[model samples]
Target chain A: MQPVIRLEDICKIYGMGDTEVRALSDVNLVVNTGEYCAIMGPSGSGKSTAMNVIGCLDRPTSGRYYLDGIDVAGLSDDELAHVRNRKLGFVFQQFHLLPQLSALENVMLPMVYAGVSSAERRERAAEALTRVGLANRLNNRPNQLSGGQQQRVAIARAIVNRPVMLLADEPTGALDSQTTQEVLNIFSELNASGITVVMVTHEPEVARQTHRIVWFRDGMVQHDNMRPADLAQMTLTV
Target chain B: MNIIESTRMAVKTLTANKLRSTLTMLGIIIGNASVITMVGVGQGAQRYASQQFESLGPNVLFIIPGSEETRDRTFQVPRTLTLQDAEAISSQVATVSAVAPQLQTQQPLSFRNRQSNSLVMGTTPDFLSVRDFGVDRGRFFTETDVQRNTQVVVLGSDVARKFFDDTDPVGQQLRIKNISFQVIGVLESKGAFLGNNQDDAVYIPITTMSNRITGNTSPYGTEVTFISVNARDEASVSAAEFQLRNLLRLRHKVVNEDDFTVRTQKDALEIVGNVTGALTLMLAAIAAISLFVGGIGIMNIMLVSVRERTQEIGLRKAIGASQQDILVQFIIEAIILSALGGVLGTAIGAGGVMIVGAATPLKAGISTPAILLAVGVSGGIGLFFGVFPARQAAKLDPIVALRSA
Candidate 1:
């Protein structure tokens, strides 16, 4: 019914004087509800910065950001944190699962902040882990899990709160090819289940799996295009 | 976040670094233990002193000659108290139970071949009841002995042992100040009082003392060191003291400052109480500094922990943990450390007090208020010192923290 993330001419500048660097410049982007999209760019292309702004992790220097119809630019730090907890889930390249917590606890963390009851948090976290094919690895800590399993745990943590949008930053950047394919299959299944997923990736092949790709370069969005599976199949047949 | 969740997380984190946590807690433990032990010992000393004063016979009052200022300023105490003044107090003061005028001097005591420096106390027969001394084997001197100036001596229990080891001391002759005096009776053992061994002193008739040895040091009458007056009862102590002061002031005549000072047992108890109380306070204050230092130690270690766990903080924040969550986590960790240390220290300190009670004469006791205060103060110190490091951890920018990690 509404776009899950919307940014209008967002500019994020770091440092001051001659050392100033524009991490993101005049960026306008929108991802509607239930859309799976990939943001692609080289190093220093502001793709990560855009993902940060969309995820409510950092504020923009100038311009408006509406996350799930709420004005994120006007919210306080705690309010932004609540929005992150309730509306968006994050999967990092490093899997950022707290090493001290088991996979189940890591997944339950978001719901803890969401004020969910302990029993419900346990139930939902278990279900989320099962969704990521990590039901048997619930008691394993990040150190004990394989790279792919750790990534899956991180993904479960990201989606355990049933966030409106899932934001992943190079989710398979640290995994082998076989593990990367398994993680992508998980993401595909998650997107198919009606959750909007946005990922920032340096791999062209990774971007090709998504329904749409938005390319970023030199602190600006250079191109955006839809490459639906049916259209790709039609192109291959032609 | 709920407090339970934060507390659990805090406990988890602290237990993760068990050695570091214990080392951090050591300062608080020592601080609390010293505070409890010192307070207990100080209070024990006060109790022991009070008990000693109580054992000096009930409802006893001392009438010292010369004002406190005069006593301090003069080389020797002015002999304002005399046998006449003691008689006046006994006759005129209705509240007085008994009056024992005393004159003390260190004299060489000789019997056969054994010779010892003995403290000789010159007092009337009333000294037996007024000072709570009893004859163990023989009878004390009669009032007629004082009137007749009899050369009779009463040997204290220890004095009897010292001179007549296997032989009977009573009815035996003991030479004092080169004057041969007969020991009429041996006193029952009255142990040490304020470091002075009462058993080492023997009593003689006041008249005999003024006539034979250490002649009159007072102008008015037989010069006495002080008058030991027993009140009729505990309630009559103040009244007796008042009447004694009035009699002495009238007898001294035209006094700008009364040349005498009367002190009751309660007054002595209070003075000892105040001294020991102040000492206890001082010890606790000094120990409190260590608690403060312990707080600082906690702050220092927490700052280091915050710096070390930057990634963990960043991850928590990114996972939608508010700054308050981070703050509470770190603060709770500190409180847990200090609170645990406080509990442990209290146990150790109470045990130490028990050991002291068993080992020494102080009757050392555990003070509940002190234990509660030490534990409460340690917890509060944790919260106070934790704020800075927790704030530092909370204020860390997640993006920067994540980048660094």
Candidate 2:
């Protein structure tokens, strides 16, 4: 099976001349459909930069980036946005739901951008919230919801567009251990349903829950490992 | 994003910051209201002045004597107008309806012992019709009185009231310049014309003033100060003016500029209209500056809003909103603010006009075009000032914005 996202020797640099900083240096990455992968790295290891490139939020300085065989390096900002909208969804550490909007409205946001009719957008957003166990909190604003509920709403918003992959950057960073496990279960269920998931995290426990892990040091990948079924079951029990 | 969704989001955001939005709208409201009110007042004043001019009778002409240079050098009054000229215009000129010669002088008026300074005008009986004056009491002096140089006077309504109180003054004696004359009639109250109170004066025969009062004689005939000619109607006014000017030129042998100026009531109104129109425009412009300031305030607030919503913008962009979508959202927000302000301002402005009309001598009128202009300008201010902040929001990089979150 082809990889859903494929990067060949990607490089992204910041500044120039004597002040150059290589945020991503000769990075190669792949995540196949239906796989749950976690990228683990210390601070300043270019993990977030790699996520940005994969999310189509930024272009690589040099090197090819292919998502479902479409080269995104040369795509214009609007075209990149189109690709991001149709193929990938994002859940951020801060649970970046618009404060003014209710959970239902926040979930409907992606469909709104996709030009879905209001009636259809509401129906799909309702279904997405139901899937995230937030059916009772649809009309509640971000402030009205708990940190866990808000993140769940963010997750619902990410999947409402029915994108091919979910890209989570520090998804549980702002959550407590209980809420973190609840969110991880949702991610696991989504991946079990054949949706590709790529998450960026620094916590060893969070990394252990994923099916595969890629470790980064500085700007390059230092190790890649797949968890055996026994190890995955032991990690889940812990 | 679609316009409906963008507008919905904009409204939600604005409502979330109700106090700030309401305060910002106040500036535009005051600016637009004041603009409408001031323009209405200025327009009302112009209309009032024109109405006053129109009340003086249509197509009537004024003939004032004495050239600027000649009057300054000689310091001597010219004996130009005579009864012969008045007769010539009245009978010979087909367009002339009536000709009334006037002799004006200041005099101390006394009824018994009560005395006051007043203008004494000597004119023919046709003065009543020609000058648009109505008799409120006894009859005016007749052509017979002009021929006889009668020592009878007509008191204006105010003069009659001052001298006689409640007593009828028609058959009473009134001393003018120490000359006792029987009051033959009481003229109607013709309110102030061009600042001079007409109801405070008295009128007599022009011949009586030349022969009995001033006592200045010329070999040609009794000299008159001025001649007021009334045309039959508006259509005949110009013809009468043309004929009279030619006749006067012939009589005075005016080879260069005439020793007189002829003006119609319309011409006077036009001059008044120009002055008031310019004043209205200037006042409207000043009010528009305040509107511009209000627009800037909106822009300032919107810029602050963009800064505060950086994460929200990034999220929207990440969710696939194009830059144009963000731009539309911000611009639509501004337009909604300004449009609401404009509607509020129009209501306030109309109320202000009504208040002025009720409280002051000024007649405040609401002009539809002025209201439309005020609203249009307000919307334009919104669009113009909204561009910079909206562009800034649109140009933000989603990566940087998301990182900031």
Candidate 3:
């Protein structure tokens, strides 16, 4: 089967002249449909840059980025935005829900940009919020909701367009331990339902929850390995 | 995004910071108000001027002593026009109807106890028909009064009221420059013209004026201040003017530069129209500058708003918003502010005009074209000034924006 995302020899360089910095270098990776993966690294290890490339938010200096079988590395800014809209969903540690919009309106925003009709946008946003267990808080603004609820609203927004892969950067970094568990459980449930989930995290506990972990050090991938729990459970079930 | 949705979002964002939005709209409001008000006042002034001119009688022309250049150069106007010239035009000019010669001077008039320093005019009985004046009581002096150089005087309504109050002043004696003359008639009110109360003046015979009052300063026979002539019909005004100019030139004898000027009512109206129209344009232009300043204010605030909302822009872009979406949203916001201000300013300006009309003699009214133009200009300003900031917002990189946030 074709992988949901494929990156080949990706390199990202920032600035120019004496102050040049390499954010990502020669990174090749692949993740199939329905796979749950974690990108792990120390500070300045280029994990965020790799996430940005995978999310189609930024282009690499030299690379091939194939999202859902279409090469998107050389696309124009607007075309990249279209690809991101159709194939990728992003969740940030800050939740990033618009402070002025109600939770439902926040979820409906992507569909607005995507040119969805008003009726369909409303209905679909409601369904997405229900799936994220934010049906009761649909009319609440971000400031009116708790951290976990706000993150749940962000998740609802992310899945509102039904993107092919969810790319999260430190999704649980701002939440407490209890809220982190709730957020991770939602991610796991979403993944179990066959949506590919790729996350970047520094915490070992969060990394261990994923089916696979790719470690990065100094702008390059160091290891790509499957989790022990997934291996043992697969062996027992088979 | 759709226009309606963008407009809705713009309104929502602006209402979220009501004070800032209101302050940003203030310049446009003041600008539109001033423009509309000035246009209405200018139109009112034009109407008032025409109304005053209409009171001067139909198909009337004025023969003034001295040319425009001579009048400008000399402090005291030269007494070049004479009573014989007026009589000659009355009898010889075929298009002429009647002629009234006037000699006006300001002097003290006194009754038994009251006194007033007012204008005293010496004219013929033709003044009643030529100037469209009506005598309220008693009779106007005839040609006999002029030939006899009688000192019988006619008091205007206000002058009569000032000396005699509600009592009749006919056949009463009044002193002008300490010389007593009997009041033969009291005129009906003719209202004020160009700030001078026409009803505050008294009238007598031109012959008496030259003989008794400011005794003939000119060597010319029966020197008159000016001659007012009526045309037989409106169509004959130009013919009458031409005939009178030729007659006067012949009477004056061999003049390259004619000593007097003959002006029709149309000429006076055109000059007044030009002056008032130019003044209106100047006032409107001054008001438009405030609109431009308001537009610049909008641009300034919008740029600051874009900077403040950089993170919001990033988030929207990340979720698939195109650059056009961002641009439309900001531009719509600016339009909403300016358009709203325009509507409010129109209301205020119209209300002010109505109030002024009620309080003053000016019949000022709301001008529709002025309102439409002001609103259109302000809205266009909003759109024009909005582009720079909106483009700045749209060009922002989501990655850089998000990182900054």
Candidate 4:
């Protein structure tokens, strides 16, 4: 089967001459539809750079990136934004929900950007919040909710547009262990529903729950491990 | 972004910081109110001056003797106007309504034992009509009385009130400059004209004053200080003025400059209008400065707002808001503030005009064109001052902004 995301010798460099530093060098990667993958690396290991490139937030220095068989490097800024909105959902470490908006309004943001009608956007946002087990907390603002609930609201916002894949950058980095486990459970449930999930993290336990793991060191992939039973057990526990 | 969604977000953000919003709006409110009130007061003064001038009548023309150069010194006095000259103008000048040759002197007049310092005006029967005076008690001196140099007098309302009191002054003997004259009539109350109290003056025959009172005979002709002529209407005023100037010039036989100045009511009104109009414009201009200061206030506050909401801008951009969306949001906020101020200013200005009209002799009229211009200029100020800060907000890099918090 064709891969959902294909990165061919993707390279991202910062600065030039004596000040030059290569964040990602000749990296090739693939993730098929319905697969859950985790990218693990140490600090300054190029994982974040790779994630930024894959998320269409930044272009590669010299390489082709294909998402669902569409070339992302050639698209303009606005066109890339359209692709990001339609095909990828993002969950950031800070849970960047607008503080002035309620949980439901935050969740409806992606659909609003998608140009969905008000009635339809509200309905879809409600469904997304319910899926994240935040049905009762829809009217609450970010400051009024716990850290876990706010993160869940962010996740609901990510999935509101029904994107093809979920891109989480340090999803549980700011949460307590218990809240982290609860959020992991939500991610596992989403993965079981057949949405492709690609998470970037440094934690081994977080990586152990994914179907495949790609380890990076000094801007190059070190290993790729596929552990089917571990992914199965993680989904079953959630 | 759609305007509705942008406006909703703007309102939400502004409401979150109520104190800041109110403070920002205060500048605009005060600015608008001051502009309205000052301009209204200025306009009121202009109207008052014009109305005062209008009460002097529209058809009357004043021809004062002596040029500006000879005004202070006693030169050869002109003897151009006489009783015959007044009669000739009345009959020959087609546009001339009436001619009242006047001679004025300050003297003491007495009736019975009552005496008062009063103004004595030596003029013909036509003076009553030309000067907009009417006899309240008895008939004015006729042409026969003027020709005969009759020692008959007419009492002004105040003169009658002071010397005659409740007693009848008509047909009674009154002593003017110690000369007894029969009171033929009582003049109506004319209030005041050009600072002279018309009600305190006594009217006698001009021929009597030139022949019997002053006792002077000119080498050229019978001399009079000034001649007052009334035109038939507003349309005939200019024609009568032209005819009188030509007639006087021909009679004086001047090879160069004439010694007399013929000033029409319209000339006086125009001078008054120009002076008042200029004053109004200057006041309005000063008021506009305050509006500009208010705009600057808006700009300063908006810059602060942009700084305060840096994180908000980042988050919105992250959620897919375009740069244009941010620009539109900030610009709209400024426009809303200024437009609100304009509305408030208009109301304050109208109220100020009304208050001035009530409190003083001036009539304050609310000019619609001025109001529209003021509001439009204020809003334009908002839009102009709002652009720089809005652009600064829009040009902020999203990544840098997100990292700022």
Best by DockQ: 2
For model 2, name the residue pairs that clash: none
- Write model 1 residue lDDT over B1-405, tens digit each, in one string: 989999988887888788999999999999898889989988988898888888866689999888989988998878878899999998999999899999889999998898999899999888988888889878899899999999999988888999999688778899998899988898888888766899998889988998899897677777998889999998898888888888888988935998888888888898899998998898888888888899899999999999999988888888788999999999999999999989888898898889989998887899999999999999999999999999999998888777665
Tens digits of per-residue lDDT, candidate 1, A3-68, equal 988889899999999999999999988889988899876778898888888988899999999888
Order the candidate numbers by DockQ, best to worst. 2, 3, 1, 4
Model 2: per-residue Cα lDDT over A35-152, one tens digit each: 8999877789888899999999999999999897889999999998899888889999999999888999999998888889999999999999999999899899999999999999
Off by over 4 Å in 1: A226-238, B71-75, B106-118, B148-151, B162-167, B171-180, B207-216
lDDT of 4 by residue, B53-142 (tens): 676589888787765455556766565556566777888888988889888778888877888898888888888788778889898999
- For model 2 chain B, give the 10-residue run with minimal summed lDDT: B64-73
Taken over the whole model, the C-alpha lDDT of each candidate is: 0.88, 0.86, 0.89, 0.81
Clashes of 2: 0
What tens-digit string does per-residue lDDT give for candidate 3 at B325-362? Answer: 99999999999989888888888888877887888887
| TM-score for the A chain of candidate 1 | 0.92
Ranking by lDDT: 3, 1, 2, 4
Candidate 2, residue B297: Cα displacement in angstroms equals: 2.2
Q: What is the lDDT of residue B163 in candidate 3?
A: 96
Best by TM-score: 3
Accuracy of chain B in candidate 3 (TM-score): 0.95
* Alpha carbon lDDT at B332, candidate 3: 94
**Reference-based TM-score of each model:** 0.92, 0.89, 0.95, 0.78
